[model samples]
Target: MTKPQIVWLRRDLRIEDQAALRAAAEAGPVIPVFVLDDETPGERRLGSASRWWLHGSLQELGDALNARGSRLILRRGSAAQVVSLLADEVGAGAIHTIRHYEPWWVKAEQDIAKRVDLVLHDGNYLLPPGCVVTGAGTPYRIFTPFYRAAMAHMPPPAPTSAPHFHAPARWPASDRLDDWKLRPTRPDWATGFVEVWTPGEAGATERLKDFLDVAAEYETTRNLPSQEGSSRLSPHLHWGEISPATVWHALDGRQGKGSESFRSELFWRDFAQNVITQFPDYPDRSFRPEFEKFRWRDPAKDENAKADLKAWRQGRTGYPIVDAGMRQLWRTGWMHNRVRMIAASFLIKHLLIDWRSGERWFWDTLVDADYGNNATNWQWVSGSGVDAALFTRIMAPLTQSAKFDAAEYIREWVPELADLTDEDIHDPPNRPRGYPDQLIGHREARERALSGYRAMKAS
Candidate 1:
């Protein structure tokens, strides 16, 4: 019998720079498999936008693999059962995949390993979570210490090149990629995603190359929502089409503030993963126990609160910067990091809505919605995280917009404001005819948020 190993492609979707694929090919003949399991528990499922993105990404991966004389086998249902069946079908002795830290994924990997030789690789993160810690050997709650600790770890391995002469034992029957119907069927809301993105590993490489060409200017330009200074690799990274290691290696030779700043972003991702690894339920609940009793404002029961949330979501909050950020996310599946901070702060602090609602909305909508980053970012903005800002520190989106000169971004996303002066754009002089009025006055909202925060801390 020819010794064979299975390469389980999860989010790390690219052929070139794939650590698990390289490892499996070196072992013996390799079989590549992708399983779609919809029954994952204690975690939310992929939203419509994510489903649409996955469809295109998988199609691209299939084409890439076919070009390399291999095929991707697709199975749907229970992950452990599918892997076990494929192992028998291919007569494979081992399974190799990039390790993932999501709670649901951790369980599935454990179950599969009990029945077979499951070799896991750290391909998703720049540094393995829990690898970095204080001298006392405990995880750091604050990002500064956590980020410093993560950087102290040996840098991630250089990205692996595509493997050679590795062919599958046989082409196992794959469910037609189209049959998954991962894309939208009716009321197609993905025209923006289609126009904004090119999904897959091939696109991932192009984006990285483009960003590197202009990296010297990135630190200054990345904050502009309308600017193209961003790497735009989040979807790729989210899908595992590009590894963090690939990004780290590409910038290794550069010695500038730009390189240092970009590296911090990667470290932040590592910091987030470390937090989630320590507290698996971090996304749905608070990391700090006292927040469990935090009296979050209830939008569902209160008419004013419900209207406030509606205004925020619909881009009619009467705060130009906040409206622009929300509109940007609505029109595109992504948002600028700075805008994300502004909108989240407005929602959690100004509207006094619960952060979870904002988080769920982003989780449903963002192409780069990683559990750790999404959860921690929301908590950070809402003053609910371990080292969060003081709740009394209210962020007025109008002030933020002026500070950042976000008129261009606002104009692009909300054309109704295109004619307004920059000063007037940040805070409207009057309610525009097509747009709604302020649902909650900014100063009043700030006071409510501060009072609520005080009540929580008092507990």
Candidate 2:
């Protein structure tokens, strides 16, 4: 009997197109393990929304494995320590896992390698991060050139089907899924999430199939919040329930601006990973150094700033579009991409809050929250990233609301404004009875943001 090969699971939860699982199954008896190593990520541990998704996803994966004459071993501790102990218990030969680039995961991988024959494979991204590079042989910092270069390697290799698992003679003890308490119970804020999302590989496949029908119209309808124009596959992709290659190949040969645009968004995911690979601390710090000196209201020190931050989080910021987006995020664990920008801008520029504060909020709230993507987006909106918009270009939420025709979306999320006319919904000529007034006048906020930018430059 060949020694059992341990396949360590992380974000790559699905069996299909999972290189590590495939390799392990082929090698010998496979023992698949998922360690709930909260200590590894420290402050970056899975958030409440993410924890809810994980419970469902893990249950689905465990059942799938059981159906295939195997089981998903659940343990809680440091991943390196758990895997080492498990390997010893099962007399496993080698540990297999997909490569991950998060700073903490990278450190965990290195630590695990020291204790076992750890084999890593790449299947998470369309192409591995550092594989695409400039003529100078260094990674490209900008997106446009990187996208052009990466296009040459378009359509990643066909994804492999789930491999047959040869079971071991004896199984190890495992923890019950219910015992983990991953889902919220006190007040149960995630009731809406259960209605909006399905958090498994099957759910991911269904979402892709649904997106294919509208993929051709993506470019035109994507920005309109009222329309289901976006794919809504972020959480699935972030969890690696569906591989990027699977999505790319699914849309292969489809002709339309929408298909092209959607594919570009996928590439952007790859681009974000490449960024964090080069800059591990990208999440907590500004990519542009001078912006560090820029004055931002500290909620801890200022009561007014604290109150404003509280209102923003509660979706009472008074700008219908911004409030709607934040509320949508609270209810659904996700937000429309266009509105995400508007809401983020309102916080960073309008409230004069540090972008990090908003980033941390999204990190805790979003089911699809990814360290690289979250930080990159917030920094981009704050004009503090390497490839960021000018700090002077503060977004006017009212203008954006009307321009994007978000009246219907606002109505759905902000019911107080539901009775308002299409003409009055976006700006709400008079404050609705229940809705709060605008946090700050758009013009006043814009000028203040610009003045702050100028001061930063002068300093």
lDDT of each: 0.82, 0.93
lDDT of 2 by residue, 291-394 (tens): 89989989999999999999999999999999999999999999999999999999999999999999999999999999899998898899899678877888
| Cα TM-score of candidate 2 | 0.99
Tell me the lDDT of candidate 2.
Answer: 0.93
Q: How far is candidate 1 from the true structure (C-alpha RMSD, Å)?
A: 1.6
TM-score of each: 0.96, 0.99
Model 2: CA > 4 A from native: none
Error of 2 at 399 (Å): 1.1
